[model samples]
Target chain A: MATVEFVEATRVYPGADRPAVDAFELQIADGEFLVLVGPSGCGKSTALRMIAGLEPVDAGRIRIGERDVTDLPPKNRDIAMVFQNYALYPHLSVAGNLGFALKAAGVAKEERTRRIRATAALLDLEPYLDRKPRMLSGGQRQRVAMGRAIVREPQVFLMDEPLSNLDAKLRVSTRTQIASLQRRLGVTTAYVTHDQVEAMTMGDRVAVLREGQLCQVDTPLALYERPETVFVAGFIGSPAMNLIEAPLEDGCARFGETVIPLSRAAARAAADEGATAVTVGFRPEALELRGDGEGFAITVDLVEELGADAYLYGTAVAPAVSGRIDATPTVTVVARLAPKGVPRRGEKVRLRIRDDAFHVFSTKTGRRLPD
Target chain B: MTATPPTRCASLPVSGRRSRRRGHAATGWLYASPTALFVLLLFVLPLFLVLRMSGSDWPLLAGNQGINVPDNFHEAVSHRFFRDSVVFTVKYTVLTTVILLALSLGLAVLVQESTRWKGLLRTSFLVPSALGLASASLLFYVLYSPLAGPFADLMRSWGFTFLGTPEGALWSTIFLIVWRYAGFYMLLMLVGLQSIPDEVYEAARIDGASRWQTFVGITLPLLRPTLTLTTVLCVTGSLLAFDQFYILTKGGPDNSTITIVQLIYNVAFQGQNDLGVAAALSVITLLALVIINIAQIRAFSRRADD
Candidate 1:
């Protein structure tokens, strides 16, 4: 096991003005699984490639287990990678495929065979020892790929969206298997995927990237519950946390005519900066339907039912006077009520949001309001 | 079943009048006449004429005295040179096929390795293949011309020459053939290489296979079909090599560079103009090619099945 560190590593492709991964810094603790997640063209994969030595790092250094290996080739990095597609050698049997790395490293024949067999046994692939990759199903091929990495017993395992190819059901199952395997082996692993759910569920800590910049790195629950930036708050959850502009009014922030109390620090900062407005963000589950409340009344537009929880997508109803209501934004508010507590469509439900759970951000910078 | 009264039809009054139907059949044949005449006139007739001429004591000139063809075939086969030429052809075919495939595999890897400068390298390798075989042979002929320079020096400049002597000539011819065809095979192999998805390579890399391991275990297996086709083409083309030997050495200082086609040309046109023996020799060469092709197909298919 090794601690894989990317110390402000940067990669700029030739002829491109902007670096694909700009000043990227990440520290994966020994035996820790860190996932790098972003949208397509977001440079998450590029970051992984740089670590694997497939692509050169233009600036900074990478260290694995205290060894500076920024310029080392993949073979010399003591790392094995499992790709999105299971790249099993089609010509070789499962056993041969599994033993290839050891053979390349010049392990003796007897030792290589023993290691391959042990790894195959661990992966439940003894029955397929002689079958070529083409003969195996997709999931089986993925396992063989995993087995190949296992035999290497590398300092780090690099997986680039390894489960992205499987069907939805298989993807879930394989994700669990890989997670459990990583836990059992206790090897430092860096997994890259665009799926936030996979990153949240699989990683010990998740790093979010956007346009080649590291947005945030934190524990999954921390990122979801206490996001430091509006981007992180909006990106980390499904149905996304809702953000609304609230004008500073008397010691409270006013949303249309309704006023919600703000912390002294927030109010003082707003007054000191002469800030007129702040953005308020709240998760769907934090809002409850109240028939008669001081909160803004919203008309239900659509509902998404997910068995256990349902989401109410709607817009805030206009006040008695409409000329001053310049923003008519539709907010998708999700409520995790019991399955029996769904409200009818078109109902005007007053909302009561948890004050402590509400996140207030600077309207100018979108930075979260400090306590 | 009650028979209905037959209705008068404009096309045929009686559907089953045998004589009228026979006449209609004759008209159908007449309507299809052009295509039938074309096949017979252009394809079958020529083939028949060749076969007949090959078997008979024919001459290049109509009134020239000709040898009996059976005697010609017997005489052609009885010669030590004919046997030696057949052996030489087989050896050259096998050697050229192996070397060409190896060279093509290497070129395919080099070109497929990167997209940067890939277009430039691919064009350079393929330019030689685009040159006609006869043209390439003539080019080599000039380069190998005694007045040009020492052959050894030229060989060393290229790293090594398979061409040095008669044996060297055989290897040199193979070298030329390999050079002429490597790019063509590389194109085939490039297609094969590109068809393999990138995910597979990533899987191999992650699985801990080094570059060499990945090539042997994944790339080569997937390239088998392309390899088979390229190998067969190189083999057949090398076996029928005539232009290079004819232009380069003109059957050589000791007749050491003579191929089967050269021997056949000598038999038919050079000395006695024995058309009968040359025809017999052509028939033998065609049969040999047919047999070899069948054998190659069988061997490849058997390996595929295994």
Candidate 2:
């Protein structure tokens, strides 16, 4: 296994005004399963492609195990890629598909067969050794695509949305399988996906990208606990973090009738930026539903009961405090509560922010306020 | 309005299904009538007429002069140029299939690879196919003429006659066919190449496949259907070769370039003026073509299955 490094990697499309991947920098440790996750068109796939040597790194250096492979071909880079669509050769049988790269590397036929059979057995594809790709189901084809990557025993594996084609149920199971498989093989894999959940569940350390630049790169727990930007805070959570834009008054942010006192650093940073407002981000699970009405009031717009975990989705009944009334902002808030505490739609409920559960960001710059 | 899913045919009652089926059948017949009429008038009727003419003493100028099936078959088989024409046609067929397929595939790969000039090259290659085959043949015939053509000076300088001998005539005609039809076949090849998704190539690249390995292991196998089509078309068109020889050689240079179709024409109108012998030859050629095509398709399908 080899450590993959992208030092200010950038890619500019032909005839385009801006680079598609703009100075992306990330260092993946050896035997690490690092995922590049972002929204669509956010350069995550471009970065993965750049690492796999499919796309040229127009302005930066890429290294695989101390080798400056910026100009090397994909074959010389010793990488295997699992495409988003599983791109199994429609003409080749399962065995042929698995052995293709080995044969291409000029490995002997006997050795190729042994590796292919071993890979097929690992993937539980022994019964499909002779079947064409069309004869296999989607999950089977996805496994074969992974088998193609594993059989080569490459220094690094590049997977671009490999589980996106599977059904939802299969995607979850296969996600775990791939993670465990990568760990067992200890291949330095760079996986790309738009799904944050997959990124959160699969990556040893997930690098979140937006607009061709990295927003945050950290372990799953770190990212959830402390997001560096307003975007990251909003992006990393399911049901999303409830970000209520509030004007600062006397070192406290006002949301409807409730007053949230900002940390000393956050208040100072906000004042230093000459900003009047800050965006308060709190996770859906970080809010405590209270009968004492200690926090802000939001009229429940909808209640989603998803068995074992229910969420109350609502909008602030009145504009969050009338004093910041330039535009009369209405914040849609989501709160994860115990299934028994779900309020009916159209009912007003109080949610109090838990201690150390909130992240503060400067409204003017979208960057996190130092706190 | 909410979008409702389309109702399936199985949801209908028996009587409703019968009526729906009747309506579908009527629409099918309505759409098929034009092609059916065209086939009957243009192909089936003429085929039957040729079959009848093959069995009767139907001369060019005289009306049907009773049955002469045995005589027609014997004369057709015993024609002086018959064996030579068959040999020439088979040779031409084999040459044309191999060269056309290879040239078009090469052109396709070159066009596919060249990013900057892809559109320009594709358009230019396809331009030659627009000219009618007979028109192209006539154009080539004039160029080959050493009498009043631009190539006349060059031929005189080099002492090279394009249609001087049997081999020269055959090759010159094959070259003309390639020029006229290479673009059309390349277009077929290009379509086949484009249908292979780009991700497949990316996967190949990461799999460490060299260019040649990818072409042989990935491209050729995936392109089998298109290859089968182009080959069959090329073989059939080459086997029934007539226009170029008729325009350029006219079975001349000691009658060394006679093809099967040309023999049929000679039997009907040039010398024998016997429509029955021409029709008998036409029937034999058609049968041979059908058998050859069937064998080709069977071989391809069996290989695909394996």
Best by DockQ: 2
Top candidate (lDDT): 2
Which regions in candidate 1 have their CA more than 4 angstroms from the true location? A256-258, A268-274, A317-329, B1-76, B111-121, B146-179, B192-219, B266-279, B297-306
| Candidate 1 lDDT tens digits, B1-306 | 233333334335555577788999999999999999999999889766656667778766653344455776887798668987888777777787777788877888898887898999999999998898889887776666444635757666676544346876776666677778888988988888888878667655645567887787778777777767776777788788888778766766567777899888888898767777777888788888889888887877676544
Model 1 per-residue lDDT tens digits across residues A1-371: 88998899999999998989999878999999999998888899999988888889899999999899997777788898887776666667888888877877789999998998899989999999989788999899889988888899999999988998888999999999999999999999999998888999999999988889998999999999888778888888877888777667786776644566888888887677777777788888888766675677777877778888888877784332222455654545555555577777898777777667788877777777766
Q: Supply the DockQ value of model 2.
A: 0.79
| TM-score quality measure for candidate 2 | 0.95
In model 2, what is the error at residue A5, expressed in angstroms?
0.5
Cα error, residue B280 of model 1, in Å, equals: 3.9
Global Cα lDDT for candidate 1: 0.80
Residue B257, model 1: lDDT of: 73
After the best TM-score superposition of candidate 2, give how far the Cα of residue A171 lies from its true spot, in angstroms: 0.8
TM-score of chain B of 2: 0.90
Q: Against the true chain A, what TM-score does chain A of candidate 1 give?
A: 0.92
Error of 2 at A327 (Å): 5.4
The 10 consecutive residues of candidate 1 chain A with the worst lDDT sum are: A317-326
Query: Which runs of model 2 end up more than 4 angstroms from their true locations?
Result: A317-328, B1-31
